[model samples]
Target: MPLPTTLVWLPETVSTDEEAFLLAAHFLGESLDGLSLSRDPLGKPYPARQGHSIPCLHISNTHDGGQRLLLAAKHENLVGVGLDMVYLPRMRSPYKNRAYLHRLAARFMAHVEFERFQRAAQQDDEEALRRRVAAHFSLMEAASKALGTGLKIGAFMGHSASLPLSALGALQIEPWVQLFFDDLAKTRLVTLKAQRWEAYWGSDDTYLISAVFLFGNEQSKQALQLDYP
Candidate 1:
């Protein structure tokens, strides 16, 4: 972890797909000429600076109809990093099919958190509540990916949407996740930051972008910004 800075940037666009690519270079501080360096085979960003060996992870995502893209990155042998951006328009009623969003939320929440969210759902509009719940679930999924294991194995598969509140509560510091944090601490890499912003596309479409950065000794002192014409 020689370099200790994590930079994140988001841009508004009329083209949802393009926004994903644009944010990648902007966050990496590279020109179009360095485009190839921003993504690995798995789409994670490689650390900048030639010959500088450091572990780096990055992710970018956009919802099916979203006008904005969310980007994330970390250095110092950072583990998995996942970012998900969904258009508010795409959220549907989960009660009709409590599979996708419901399952995701169930896997991410602690017992108390799940109960609180569930109570809120009972009183709120079903569609709106689904969006909120999905957003939260996605955030946790992103955070979990940043710590490694992604959302494919372990905690993810072990838990389902019907998980008990008490069981969800126990997820705060699971042994596997704890071990990841321990490794970061042992290596003196212990910085975490999150950002949220709204982006406009073509004056008609808009979406929100949330980003998280994880690093340790090598961190930037200033917020990263990139200009897109």
Candidate 2:
């Protein structure tokens, strides 16, 4: 029926987000004709047509806006996917400013990770740090998007005694959370690790983009299907 799983296409140059998504739908449909696109309650794209159920195709599009755009799609039963793009901050960009970057990182990155960021900032070269943060930011966006919930800022609410369902949220890198969360903790962690979730990146001189995909587990499917509207 549909093409094999992990069918991704990053077509070039479409003027607007609407244009990009339209291209993505038609591109996927062409491979599996008569198939159209639809959004689930949480806005993740999936192939569909009237009178038929949503296909197992899990599609993701880059929500980061820039001069360029990308879309990734999977069929044949992959459960989750996320595509994200980040504009590499220019030499004069605020992101390249050492102090600013660290401040921003401290807010969004895990304390340990931010400490790592601080160390990188100590180097004479700022470019490496810029690229590192951009890449990490790309992973964060992909993680949230892949989860199909965007970012769950609220998942950090309440106390650690009964930690929230941390897995559904992404980018919960608050410095405080690090102490309460660890490898052996019973509560799901909000961190995105390279081992469990795969984040693949591609970058040009100006932009960095990523596609995160997974066969995914039943727990993830249930979270995505029932958690968000």
Candidate 3:
């Protein structure tokens, strides 16, 4: 079966994290009141029942500007999953300025990754560069979240070796997506497979959405699937 992932777009007036949950409950055809939810020590939400875990389902959520998206995977054999969405505006103007951009690259990017961003930025116009950087950041964040480490340990691990600047410039999803699996193998941070989806909302709004599945091994490349709109 395909990955049970779902995306929900919320209007500006009603945008909230809770809406994602509501959509999940709707997608599952269950009333929100019937589901028991709990958070781990790190504050990630998961499904629970009578203080026991629900092993069959995994969920992750993210929001950007006025839009919210969720990923719900029903896996009889898989483990954990993570989702992330980044707003295009988050990486625009002052945020993408030289000083701020350099700081962000230093914080989350390895030296080689930073170099690639630099090269790409020099070649592309400001808007294109901003979108690429935002998407990269979103993917990294999604991977980290899938590992249950958030940005603490996962972000610092070396990813540039797998996700080179050349892949980003190639503008091909397959090559770019492969880098996530490659990074997982090289770092062994967590055994997971990742896939990303990009969406354009309004005339001016764009988002980079990513998901990662955990406990996935070599065969995961074949088992994992992504649904994009």
RMSD (Å) per prediction: 10.9, 8.8, 7.3
Residues 1-229, model 3: lDDT tens digits: 4455555555555454555565675786645655666777666677765667677677777776767667766665556666778777667766567666657655666555566567657655666656556656666666555555455444555333333321121122233352233333334343333222221211246666766666544434443222111
Best by the lDDT measure = 3
Name the regions of candidate 2 deviating beyond 4 angstroms. Answer: 1-22, 25-34, 51-55, 63-68, 75-77, 94-96, 116-124, 152-196, 217-229
- Is candidate 1 or 2 superior in TM-score? 2
lDDT over C-alpha atoms for residue 83 of model 3:
73
**lDDT of each structure?**
0.40, 0.49, 0.54
Better of 1 and 3 by lDDT: 3
Report the C-alpha displacement of residue 188, candidate 2, in angstroms: 9.1
Name every residue pair that clashes in candidate 1: 4-218, 4-219, 5-218, 80-146, 110-168, 110-169, 111-165, 111-168, 111-169
Higher TM-score: candidate 1 or 3? Answer: 3
Q: Could you estimate the TM-score for every candidate? A: 0.46, 0.61, 0.65
